[model samples]
Target: MDFELPEEYAAITDTVRRIVEAEIKPVIGAYETSGEFPYPVIRKMGDAGLFGATFPESLGGTDAGFFAITAISEEFSRLTPEFGYAMNQQAMTCPFTIFNWGSDAQIERFVPDLIAGRAIGMFALTEPGGGSDAAGAMKTTARRHGDIYRLNGSKQWITFANACDTGLLFAKTDPAAGHAGITAFVVEPKRGRGYRAHPIAMSGLSNCLRSCAVFLEDFEVPVENRLGAEGEGFKIAMNALEYGRLTVAARLTGLAQACLEHSVTYSKERLIRGKPLGEYQMIQQLIADMAVNIPAARALTWRAAWTMETGRPSSRAAAQAKYFAGNAARHAAQAMADIYAGYALADEYPVKKIAAYVNMLTVGEGTPNVQRILLAEDALGIKDTDRHPVRNRARGHLSR
Candidate 1:
């Protein structure tokens, strides 16, 4: 029943907070204005061991565990949501997946650079067709040759695609086999042939982070780069997402807290009718909603993190956390906009950016509708989320 985070985890949080203030806060605006990635800040974070929280010391990580990574995500996003995504992209999905399901040689080759932020990593799962039904509707295919697999397909909404030195790319090896046909490959775009990335301009996180449409035409990946056996891609992707959703929820919680803090500050300073805006009941109500929602979202996220850390079935908890946290972030964004009124739209103020970030969060990880459907199926005895092979495997590995 202990709710407090361990002292070591708290120390990690404190270090990240300092890094954000010293390295990010000072230069983030310039990067946003220029629409550029903050490589220096990222390197600083890497130097501070921010990206290595979940890995063992042998792999250049502290093995701080899932809860520590979740807390670190929250601290990163609290001030800047764009940087928070780096935690997930670089540490959570791509590297962790490779660590979990990859061969010893593969882990030795990629994990250290990724966790050190010496290399950027991307997770290429969602296709142009659709993300919610990624495995079912996947258009990507990986055909085996001699020592290499020739891959061809276009991936949509791929974060860090434009800059990733390496990534986990999924494609169907046996297209007729449906979900079971999918296979995972570690594609090195920097050294590999036939990999093209076109950045997609978006309203949110446009400046600091780049989401792209990635086209793989006759791309050659070595046979040794394959993760697990053929047809295990879907399972690996889902397992990674079980971890990904927690980070997503943590980011939303941080965003909600930021909105609440900003609203409270504005309420005290904004004068209307010869009194501060905080004096108004309507303003109080909006702030109150944010105040309430933020903690609830955070609590759910922590619960999910604990579940994953303890090697328990976490799909239900992750979904619940992500669903509630996304809604909370959306609500907080709206409240911030309402409180700011005309100022919310101005670039000088962060409200507009926060709102746009919230909009993206709604669809990331899993959409609200998608999460609802999963939960519904679970509740109706149609699916036993706790009884998956992935969860069982995770239990054995994570428990250690």
Candidate 2:
């Protein structure tokens, strides 16, 4: 129940907040308008040891711990939601999956470059048919060949799809195997070489993530590039998601904080009648609700993070965190908009822009409705604690 973060973590969060204010906050709008990726911002974070913040030092990291990474994500998201999300995915994306399940050669090949920002990476899971039903609706397949696998599939709404050089790709090897038949691969995506991408006309996170539909048309992949055993793709993917869901929670929490801060500032300066908006009971109520939700969501997210760090199962915890944070961000966005009235629609203010980011949070990674079903299962005691097998396996890898 101790709410205090360690001194080092606090200091790092402070620095990250300043960086977002000075760098991302000032220029993110331009990037959004130009539809360009923020290579310089990613490089700055890499230089600040953020890319390697929580990874092992042996892997060219600073061993900053996962909680610290989440803290930095939270601070940056307040200023620019896309920036916060991009930062987390930049450090995580495919590299985290490689560290967990890739063969030694694969890890040796991708880890250093990804962490150093010399190479880029991302995750490919969602498809055009469905996202919530990821396993059930996945149509991508990797057919076995003598020395390589021929991959064919279309992955839509893939974050950093066009920007990254490599990513963790999932495709079914055996349709009858159902979820068990899925396999994971680290594929190098190059145009016309079995890999092509078309930018998705997304409403939010346009500049932050640069999402697209990646088409793997008979792409050749070396068998050695497989992340895990033939049927282990689902296991590995779920495990990565357990942690990724927490990261998403962390991002949503940051957006909520932004909403609260923006609302509070507006309340003080915005005079209504003879008094400031802060003096009004209805405005006060909105602010109060927003203020309360931010910490609640944060506490849930950190608890899940701490549990995983302890090598404990986190499927349930991650779900709870994601659900709470998503709901909080959504409500807080609307509440901030309510406070701003017409100003909410202005680009100079955040409510209009951040509301879109809220959509990204609630829908990406896992949907809010999906999270609710999980929580209900947990409450009903129908969920198995052993479902998330990847957490322990990942811990074993990190320990080694």
Question: Considering every candidate listed, which one attains the maximal lDDT?
Answer: 1
Whole-model lDDT for model 2 versus the true structure? 0.79
Off by over 4 Å in 2: 1-3, 21-30, 390-394, 397-400
Q: Write the per-residue lDDT of candidate 2 for residues 1-400, one digit (tens) a residue.
A: 5378789888988788777777777877788778777777777767677777656778777777678767777776776677666654567656777877776788778877777766667889888889988889999999999989999989998887787777788999997888999999887775327888777786544555577888888999888888878988887777778777877888899899888988999999999897999999999999999888988999999998787677777788888888999999999999999999999988777687789888887888789888877778778889864365444433563321
* Model 1 error, position 60 (Å): 0.5
What lDDT would each prediction earn against the true structure? 0.86, 0.79
TM-score, structure 1 vs. true: 0.95
Prediction 1 global C-alpha lDDT? 0.86
Q: Please write out the lDDT profile of model 1 over residues 49-111, one tens digit for every residue.
A: 888877788888877788888999987888778888797778888888888888779988998
Models, CA RMSD each: 2.2, 2.3
The residue ranges of model 1 lying beyond 4 angstroms of the native Cα positions read 1-6, 390-400
Model 2, C-alpha of 262: deviation from truth (Å): 0.5
